[model samples]
Target: MTIKKWFKSGSPWIWLNAGAIAISMIMVVGLLSLILVRGFSHFWPAPIVETTLTQPDGRQVQLLGELSRSQTLPAQVMREAGVDIPSDIDLVTRHLIKQGNRDVWGRDFVWYPETGMDEWRYPKEAMRLERREWGDFYGYPVRLKEEGRTVAEGEKLWPELQQRVDRANELFDEIRGIERGDIGAVNHRMERVRLEERRLDMDRRAGRIDRASMEEATVELEARRAELADEYAVLQQRLDQLYQDVRRDTLVGRVMDGREVEIPVGQIIRAVQPNDMSVVSKVGLYVAQFWDFLSGYPREANTEGGILPAIFGTVTMVFVMSIIVSPFGVLAAIYLREYARQGPLLRVIRISVYNLAGVPSIVFGVFGLGFFVYFVGGAVDQQFFPAALPSPTFGTPGLLWAALTLALLTLPVVIVATEEGLARIPSTIRHGSLALGATKAETLWKVVVPLATPAMMTGLILAIARAAGEVAPLMLVGVVKLAPTLPIDGHFPFIHLERKIMHLGFHIYDVGFQSPNVEAAQPLVYATAMTLVILIVMLNLTAISIRNRLREKYRSESD
Candidate 1:
């Protein structure tokens, strides 16, 4: 009767907890799946080729990207990027044209076909332009006659311009390879080696050799050096100007000037490369960038930058901290459960653990910044990385500090879980092992810890999940907006601890809030947000799977 009552009373509470957990799992999973779908959607879209036709009549047929109106670009877009135009001549109009300029329909691309460069969906890699029959009229209409201009004159200019650009680019590449003093460095070093030999020769024939001949040799060398140097400088300057014209990123006007007009992240990033002209290509670029944004972590120097290195930096620091904290947390839990006297002190320690858990993550961030970044890191840098000092490699918020802070924040959770797991093993288990002549240490290693592995792992997974989502602590410690270089590479053992890093949370915040072009960045921000959510969900799913497996393995049939 007592057993029946206990079972009946516990059933409702058990079902309630299970239901809550199930609901939460379903909600999070569904939301994350939706986000992942949307992010991936940005990739594959229908492909269409755009063209133009000038019939035997003077009428120009405009070929849009597709028959129906496309929300996509190059086909019906009136403004190819910043080049604005007539509002009515938009994507819908292009769709009307692509419908074969059908007389059956009042509006269509065929009747008034136009494959205008002005509304290019994307900059085509190669425009198959050749002298071909435009329905039988075989003449360049804009060509400049003896003293006249015709319809074909403008048409020929693009091919000519392309040729010139190719030649110019080739020249620029060659000249850029010529380094300052490269020729002279080799010559100068050789001269130094030959100086002693030359001295002897000169002494032997000082009067016999003409002074003018020596002067001429020196002048010739200098002239050759100056000629190469001038040619290189000119080519470099031209390349720099051309690069600037293409990207148009520097509102500075001069290299050192500054007065930035706010622009969106997508706009700026798109402008960085011409290949990002197509909708598909643009989508691809963003996906790759965001993937880097999501997976690697990101950071910047001051305000605007990426977060890949920061993720790397954070993970490295935390992994090290885990190695440091795991033993300490476990040992403390063991002593408290088995060795420490159970008294007021033990109760006070428990209270302290609770208080520490409640302390804000940002507080840990601050402490990490102050103690770990500054003092300990400063000391290490001063002793070993003296060359990089005053820049504050360790002594400012950084990876090491962030790890330590998170470790501190998570330590209590680990300790509390470990203690609980240790306590949960029936007293009989311990007594049974000891009764069989096993030492306490042997029991812990062979029995207690083994049975408690699942609980300990649960605590660890929770700690990791919490740490991965941590933003405030990172903000205080090492969360930078952008970083100049990657933290990992191959250079004499190769992990660069001094570098800053990026995080996805920080990236979404930057793109959504701090981006220069807020309007353009909106879609990308949603996309990025979706990506981050999917990643966090993936992590949680892995943890939950492990937990489920353990629960199935350990659940007692009697219970």
Candidate 2:
């Protein structure tokens, strides 16, 4: 066939589209593979290398670390950089070692020339200690201590150290429970009591307070405070006991330079002798660490631990936005497609919605802040939550407002999709239903809307995909660096809409760009981004499954 004939037959366009799709798929697969490799590999335990190196100035230094990476450079460059490379060699190799005793080494990573290294060995006794602060410690366990007194030494110290870590973890759990659980509940109750008193005071100033009621409230408040004070004292005692127990134990480790340092057992997350681990043991530890990353809360300025809060918040916000946007979007689309007259107003509305879909997300965020938070939320707070005045409750950035804002931002997509679905339904079916004496509403709901359900779900899926990855708008609306509590909790009226939340996308942004410890936070960024992508995929899959079911169910009815 001639080129002109192929073009006219649309074969050229089809081939072009296929090529574009293949390229897009390859790019996406490649990106996801890179993320997976970088993220999941972080949990694996690598053998610690202990080696001696000859410095360029003829001095020898001892080093213990993990071989992180290697690179090759021209011999001329190495000599020019004063690296003492041999003149005969065309290229020189150097290794970047992750000597992670950052507190002692002054740096986490260091580059050493291969030519200057000697006596490389992976010591079976070498240990890697993951700490709460000061980064990881690469050393050998010397002894176990209690309040500066040695309790165990040599081989016995390893088992003792493990036992103490387990004990310290338990104590840490108790401390967290007291501070964030029991104490948190007490604090919330005290805040409610304070707000109640302030409400009564305001009523008195306005000459609307009842004397008997005011006296009863005052008595109740005093009794509650007294009860809380007693509970607080008991919690304080437990906290003191935990601190004492935790601080008593310490692990003494000998570094590369043979400098012995004492690290409190409570401050260490895990102490692993990577060089001593068998394959099965290493695999088990790797799985455990990965699971911990999935379920744990972040620490050390979000450079360590897991992002459970972010995952919860992202899922909750997307679920809420889907719930809110679906009905409104479907209803508007139905009116435009089924009920509204074909006129200039309908055309204008369609144009407006499509335009809205193209509007910047940040612009939506600003609008949400101004109109939803400052205006609507402010009014609600004034009328109903006046007790918490001055300190705005609903009139602030929160999960509810974030969900609502995302719903508004993604509404246009739903409207367009639903309208297209409705338009695609044959008019003969509606006419047949009407001819059978069915009312317009009955015909539309039973015949037309049912067939269009799949399209509505398709729109919802798109909206969820878009909203889940959004960080810019959420930053302005409700997403924070850290959330003390989730939006949904055990509290009464369980879904607390007026609470700030952490989001995976925002967490990635913060850890990648805004964290104080950039080097430590870099890997976490990839991990978080991978997690967010997984979450979005799960949500879309659910929506798509529902859409598929609906389509199958309505296939015969539409025909």
Candidate 3:
């Protein structure tokens, strides 16, 4: 039991390993707990407090906001910082009030000492408005207005406002569908027509165009343009109608400053009086907010709303990358482990692949940009899409280039994993298959590959886990702060690999570090981080499940 004796007996090593594992588990649990508490709680309806903030000059200022956070600091530190600390206690309590009427208060959050606040109470009538801009508005509903005229007043206005919001949301959805879908498709088609015309013009300039053929093409192009113009005019008229409907309703609410402001109903995302809300209502609101976070597109420079695009982009890129990396990785591993003559050259190649795994991912991004985009993509554009020249379709940083770069970045891990898996298979199996008149290629493809699927999947899982969380490489390759259009749409060649994409990893970095509204973006950062973790876990779990299923099937066959 002596320390040296225990160490000699390997008990010390066992204890050390246990301690390391315990510490790691604790760290992980703690991190997850912090994220969950901070992230999930953000959706809960917090009561709005109507209070009088007693200023040092003996003047009371009316304030309305949600009580967000509280902290206790040493009184000595408070006093040193020139805060009016009470003499009775060694600690001074302060609370961060989310005074969210940013336009009125000129600030989203404010801190007040306990002693500096008087008659603060959670009022049932106090409202919190989630606006499209200027952040949240803290006020009381004075009335509801439609087209500058009073529609509903007092308590009756609440139900009326809700109805209008529903109507506005529906109209908004319609407008969005028209703008992003129909109009977008029209724009794409129009662009194609323009490109076609350009191509025709180039041919004419080269004296390759027949006069009759050119005239026919011009007529066709003009006819298409006229049709598109008519369609656009009709769409514009419908959009105007929708806009009028969406903008007609307004809420006349009295802010904390006693100023009655008219907030356009179209600008409001949600309005809720949290203090008046029942438990059931609160739960409903919470679910609604959470769902919005999950499904909604981001706004306000990605500080507000959901991250659907980022999620979609991340998953799609990873999926595409997996498809690309799997075969190449497996083939390379096969060549090295099964077929390649082992010598100095083979050893050098193996070492190179391993070293490539250690290369910084951003380097791969640069390589992708230079090689895949500028060189190969430029060649593609020149050879195939010459009309779209200078506009740079595949020649630009895009989803395909990003996926390919990530595939290259993660290929080594896959190769190493596959090699290990291939090496583990008994040579007798291969020999037996060959002995039974099975060709080497057939045995390798059917028997060897099947058994090694789980290992391949494991490598894929690793690759995906790394690729999904990567932001640096993506920034250079394809990721943007916000991508207005998704890579996938109803356009020709349905999956637009040339489109730039939003990625959760990049979104987190942008909101957390690059955002101007740091305080407001903090919660979003935590929530996004938590979401990214969940997404990665889900993807890994899916791959792991497939791997497990394959392993089980093969194991049973072997038995």
Candidate 4:
């Protein structure tokens, strides 16, 4: 076709649209691939390299760690950074070595020019310890000691060390169970008793109860407190025993500098000789590490370990928000579409709803903080929990407040979707129902709503996708860097909506920006970002699946 004819026929625009879509799809896939490679590769066991680095001053130093990253730097840039780079060379190769004995060297990574590095070797006996604190340790195992006595050395030390490490981990689990389960329960009960006693005292002061009754209630609460204290004591005793057992064994490791350092068995999460591991062994270790990253609780300022709590909190908050927003949004849409008169006032209200959807999410967070927390929550605390005044149970940032705020923020989307769905139903159907002697309410309830279910789910899917990745609003409403306990637990009422929660979105922000160790935290940032994307996709897919099924069901019924 001629150019003018093509323009008039919109052929150019069609091609242009296709090109744009193709580019967008490519960009999305590329971004996801980058995240997957950078994030997932971190779990694989990389062989540790021993090298001698010659300094600009002609001093040689031993280096031991995994090769993290390599980059080409301009000679001028290297010179500007005070590194000795020859002017003859235009580009200098630099390597970022993850020399991960952070506790010994005070740094986890260091950049070295490739020119100064030589004598690279991989020692089979080289060890890497993933620890509970101070990051990873790179060294060679010298001996295994039990309670300061040498139990094994030389070739036999490796097997003995592995066995004792396993035993230490088992004891660690026992200690954690005692502390978080039995002891936690006792502490919770004791706090309840204390609150009850305070309530009784307040009632007495207000003359709401007789003095004798108040005294009896106080005595009973005190007895309950004493019983809980005894229970805690027993649990504490068991935890102490576990701690001793876990710490009884130690590994003497010789670091790159040839200094022997003793590490407690309890502090080591995993021990591996990467150089000696076969491909199969490395793959197995990768799977275990990846699983732990998904299921373990984060430690070390959220720079290490798994994000199970964040995952649970994100899903729980989204689930709760969906439940709260659905009925309210659907009902509002029904009223506006089926009941409200089409006039200037209705048009204005509709315009306002659309505007609300465009409002900044941070504004909604402020509103939630003021109206929901300070006003509603404060009132609840006053009326229902008068004795807990200063503490302000509900009058604080918590899981319920965050969910409610998100529900409010996404309500307009749901309303718009549902209204559009309702409008799509032919007017003839309503007239037919009316002619059949069905009331307006019956026709709307039985016929209109069922057919519109899919659209409602579409809105829910959008809401979940947006809310799951939202960080700013959640930060002000409820999300915390580290929540000591989950909102849901084996406590009275089961789900404590008043508790603060960890969210994957917030965790990403914290780890990426707020971490003290920038280089070490970089990979974790990508991993967490990837995790958030995956979570949002999963939630959206679930909603999409439900919507499709509902649409199919209604279509079949109509046929």
Q: TM-score: which candidate is best?
A: 4
The global C-alpha lDDT for each of the candidates, from Candidate 1 onward, is 0.54, 0.90, 0.90, 0.91
TM-score per model over all chains? 0.54, 0.95, 0.96, 0.98
Q: Which has the better TM-score: candidate 3, or candidate 4?
A: 4
- Model 2 residue 447 CA deviation (Å) reads 1.7
Once fitted onto the true fold, the runs of candidate 4 whose alpha carbons sit more than 4 angstroms away are 86-88
lDDT tens digits by residue: candidate 3, 297-412: 99877888899999999999999999999999999999998789989999999999999999998899889989998999999999988898888888889999999999999999
lDDT of 2 by residue, 469-538 (tens): 9989998888999999878756688899999999999999999999886767878888888888888899
Output the number of the lDDT-best candidate. Answer: 4
Better of 1 and 4 by lDDT: 4
Q: Please provide, for model 1 over 129-244, each residue's C-alpha lDDT reduced to its tens digit, 9 standing for 90 to 100.
A: 11011110101112222112221235464444344334444443443343323433444444443443454345447674466766665666566667656765675676566444
Could you arrange the candidates by lDDT from highest to lowest? 4, 3, 2, 1
Per-residue lDDT over 491-545 for candidate 4, one digit per residue giving the tens place of the 0 to 100 score: 9899999999999999988998999999888999898888889889999999999
Looking at model 1, residue 421 earns an lDDT score of 87
Which residue pairs in model 2 clash with each other? none
Q: Report the C-alpha displacement of residue 128, candidate 4, in angstroms.
A: 0.9
Candidate 1 TM-score, C-alpha based: 0.54
Worst 10 residues of 3 by lDDT: 83-92
Score residue 524 of candidate 4 by CA lDDT.
92
